[model samples]
Target: MKRKPPTISPEDSELFRDAIGDVRRIEAEPAAPARPGPPPEPRRLRIDEEEALRESRRAPADLALDAADLLSYCRPGLPERVFRQLKRGEYSIQDEIDLHHLRAADAEALLKQFLNAARRGHHPCVRIVHGKGLRSEGAPVLKSLVDRVLRHRGDVLAFASAPLNQGGSGAVLVLLDER
Candidate 1:
C-alpha cells in the first residue's frame, strides 16, 4: 500500500537549530581557505634520457668505479665525474616507492619486480618509502617484510636508509644485483 512519509515537526527543527547556535551550516559554506597568491611555476632537474639507458646497461659491478676511474674516460680536472655521471639521470635511475598502503598480499609483486630488474642486467636501485609507523596500530609491517625478503632475496645486494634529502630515515635505498 502507498503511504505518505511522516513529516518532522517544525518545533523539532527549531529546537535543533537553537541547540547548534554557534555551529555553522556546513552544507552552505566555502569549501577551502582563501588563497594568498597565485601558484608558483614548477621546476624540473635536467635529465639525459640516452645516457640513462646506457648507464642502466652497464653491469652493476662497473658502478663501483670511483671518480678517479671516470677521469680516465673523460677529460682532466673533473673532480667528481663519477657522481656527476650518475646524477646525469643516465646510469643510475632513481624511483620512489610507497609502502604506506601496501597490503601483505602484494609482496609477491615486489619480488617479481626485483627479479625482473636483476634479469635486465641493470644496476637497478629504488627508494622504498616505508613511512614511520606513527599512524599504524602495530609495528611497521612493510619495512619488516622488506627486511625479511632481503635476507633471502638473491637479487638484493644491499639496502640502507636514505639521507635527509632522500626521504630520511623513513625510506631505504635498495641496490639490486645484475640481471
Candidate 2:
C-alpha cells in the first residue's frame, strides 16, 4: 500500500517563501562524459629501482679474492671441449653483468637475477666483469663473490676468466644451461 504525500497549507507555503528572498531557477548544463586516464605506473619496477639505489649506497662487503687469480668452473658431466670453448670465449656472449664496485650482497643479488634472466631467455653464453681488486683494500670482493655464486648455481654449465682482450682475470665468460 502507498501513502499520499503530506499536503502543505497555502498560508504556510506563502509564509515560508516570504521569510526567504526569491531565488532564480538554476539552468543545469549537461556534463561531458568522463574519459579514462592513462594506466597506472609500474609499482614493482619502481620498487626494484629504489632497492637498487639503496644497495648502491651501502658500503662494499669485506669478501676478497686475489686480483690475478683466474676464475674457472665446469660441471662434472660437461664435455671437456665445451669447457675449453667457454675458457677460450668460443661462444658469443649474448648478455653480461658487471659487478665492478658493487657490495657483496648487491653483486650476488644482481648475479642471480641476471643468470635467471639469461636462463629463462635461453641465452647460452654471457660475461661478467667483476673487476680486478687492485683498488680494493684487501682483495677483489666482487670477483670472489661472482666465483662463489656461479659455482653454486645449477644452471651454470661452465665459466672461466674471459680472454685477455675481453677483460682477462677481471671478468669471466659464463656458459649457461639452455632452458
Candidate 3:
C-alpha cells in the first residue's frame, strides 16, 4: 500500500504560518524561442565579380573611355569643336555633383542618377567634381570611375576636364543629350 504524507495538526500549521512571512504570487509567463527570419540582402561585390560584370556590360569601342589618360570623350558624329568649347568652360553649367569622399561604387551610382536627372530636366551642361587622387593610395579612384561611367552613358554627348578656375583635372564638364 502507498504511504500517505503525514498531515500537520491544525495547531502546528497555525504555529508554522505565524513563523513564516506572508507570500505573494507572480502572473508572468516564460518567453518562447524566437523564430528565424529570411536571409539578408547582399551589399558588397567581390573584386572579381565586379570586374566581370563591368566587362560583360562594357561600353562599345567608340564609347569606351580610358581611366589613365585625360578625362575626355565625345560620341561619334559630334563636332570636335564642341568638345574643345566644353574643355574651355564655354557652356553654362546647369547642375553639378561632387564625389570627393565617396567610394567607387557609390560615386558610380550617384553619377548615373545625376546624369539621369540632368537629362530628364533637359539640362544641356553639368559639372562633376571628382577630386584628384592626391589623398588616394594610388590612382584617383572616383575620377576614373566617373570617366568610365560617363563614356558609357548614351545620354552623355561629351565630357572634358574643367578649366583651372572650375577645378581643372579634378573636375569634368559633362554635356548631356537634350532628350
Candidate 4:
C-alpha cells in the first residue's frame, strides 16, 4: 500500500546508498588486530606491607646531615693507646662487632641502639666496624657517618681507629660514657 518510499529523490537515494555501503565496508574490515582488552584482573593492594615499606624508606633525620658536614667533625685522629685499650676490652665494652657486611641503611640505628643500651648498662666501651670504606664511594660513607654520629652523641666519650692487628685502620673502638 506504501507509495514506493514517497519517491525518494535520486540525489537523496544515492547519498543514502553510499553511506550504507561505507558502513558495510567498515564493519566487514578485519577486526582491528583484536583491540587489546582490559587487564586480566583487578590489582590487589597490600596495605600493611605498603605501609611498612613506606615507613622503612623514611630517613633517620628530617634534615639529612650532609656527609661532608659529618666528616668535618668526625676526624680519624684518635690515639694509638685508645685503640689498644679498645682491642683489649679493658673498659667494660659489651660488643665488638665486625661490620663488614652491614648495609649503609643499618649502620646508624645500630650505632644509636648500641650506645643507648650501653649507657643504660653503664658500659664503658664498644668497638665498631668502619671497614676502611675501600669499596664505598666518596670518602668512605660509613666511617664518616659513624664518626659524626658518635661525636654528636652524648654517650660517646672518645673513639679511635684501630691498629694493624685489630682490623687496622678499617675499624674504631668507641668509649661510651658511664652514665
Candidate 5:
C-alpha cells in the first residue's frame, strides 16, 4: 500500500526557484534554555505508605490458637454488656470480609485495611469470616491473625465469635470505635 511521493520535474523545480527570486535561511531561536521543570511533587507520604504496606505483607509471627476455639476481645474500659452484645451478634453487621483461603500475610493486610475503611465509613459493626482454618497445616493461621490484629487496633472496641446461626466459631463480630 506504499506509494512513492510525486516528485517535481527538474524544469518545474527551476521554475519554482525563479518565481521565488531569493530566500534566506531562518534559524530557530535557540530553544529557550531548557529550564528545569518544577521539582517533582513530594512523594514522602506515598513512599511511607508503600513501605508500611510492604512491612505489613511480611508474615506475622505465629500465635497458638486452635481452629475450633471461639475468639473474643474487649478493649480495656469497654463495658461487659457491650462485649456480651457483640458475642450475641446483636449489633447489625454493616460490613464483612471473608479471609477463607488467603495466606496469613495477605489476610492480615486486608483485615487491617478493611477495618480502617469500616471505621472511616462510620460502620459500628463488621464481621470477619476466617473459616476456622480447617485446611491449615498446623494452627489456624488467619483466625489467629485476625485475633492479633484486632487486639492491637485502637479502633476495635470489642470482638467475639459469632453465634451458631451466624457462622459460629468460624467468624467474629467486631464492634468498632467511632472515628
Candidate 6:
C-alpha cells in the first residue's frame, strides 16, 4: 500500500502563492580537490661537478700564499684610503662568521653564502674569523681558503686581516658593496 502526496485546495493554494511572492533556483559549481600533503622542500644549491673537479685539482701554491702577515684584496678603483681603514679595523663590523673548526669545503660554502647574504641585507662591513694556523699542520687551511674565496667574490669591495686585538692575522674585516 502507498499513500499519495496531499493536493492543495484551489483557495488555499491561491492564499499560499500570495504569501510567497517570488522564488528562484540556483546551481553551484563543484569545488576543487584538496592537495595531498605539505609543499615540496626547496632544492639546495650545490657546486657543479666540473667546478668541484677543477677546485680539487688546484695546487696549494696556486690557491693561496704562505705569508705570515695580513691577507688582503681590494677591487681596482676602490679608494686606497678605505682599504687602509679596513686593514686597521676602523669600520664597525655589523656581523661576523667564524670558520674556526669547519672543513675547507664547508667553510668555503658558508663563506660564499654569508657574503651573498651580507650584501643582500645591505650590511656594509662584516668580520670573518678564519683562525690562525696554530692548530693547522702547515699553512692555515681555512685562512688560505677564505683569502681565495673573498678575493673572487664580486660583492667584496675590500678585505684585510683584522687588528691585533681583533684576532690579528686570523680574522678579516670585509667591506661589501652597497645594495
Give each prediction's root-mean-square deviation over alpha carbons: 20.6, 10.0, 13.3, 18.8, 13.4, 10.1
Clashing pairs in 4: none
Clashing residue pairs, backbone N/CA/C < 3 A, model 1: 51-90, 52-90, 55-91, 118-179, 119-179
Q: Which candidate is the best by TM-score?
A: 6
Report the poorest 10 consecutive residues by lDDT, candidate 5: 41-50
Q: What pairs collide in candidate 2? A: none
What lDDT does each candidate get? 0.50, 0.82, 0.79, 0.60, 0.84, 0.80
- Index of the highest-lDDT prediction: 5
What would the per-residue lDDT of candidate 2 be over residues 1-179, giving only the tens digit for each residue? 99999999999899999989798999999999999998877565456546654654463554346899999889999999999988988899999888877888888888888987887688889999989988887877788778767766656789999999999999999998774
Deviation in Å, model 6, residue 91 alpha carbon: 0.7
Cα error, residue 57 of model 1, in Å, equals 35
Q: Across residues 41-153, which tens digit of lDDT does each residue of candidate 4 receive?
A: 41222343344346545635444333223122222565667645655545554767665667766876676666666666766766677677767755676776676566566
TM-score for each candidate, following the candidate numbering: 0.43, 0.64, 0.63, 0.49, 0.66, 0.67
Clashes of 4: 0
Which run of 10 residues does model 6 get worst, by summed lDDT? 41-50
Taking the tens digit of each residue's C-alpha lDDT, what string does model 3 give over 1-179? 99999998999999888889697888788798788898764333234335544763664445433333468788998999998899899999999999999988888778777877887798989999988877776567787678777755666789999898998888999998885
Name the regions of candidate 2 deviating beyond 4 angstroms: 1-64
Q: Which portions of model 1 show Cα errors greater than 4 Å?
A: 1-93, 118-121
Error of 4 at 169 (Å): 1.1
Pairs that collide, model 3: none
lDDT score at residue 117, model 2, on the 0-100 scale: 83
Question: Candidate 6, clashing residue pairs?
Answer: none
* Residue 38 lDDT, candidate 5, scale 0-100: 97
**lDDT of candidate 6 over 81-114, digit per residue (tens):** 9999999889988989999999998998888889
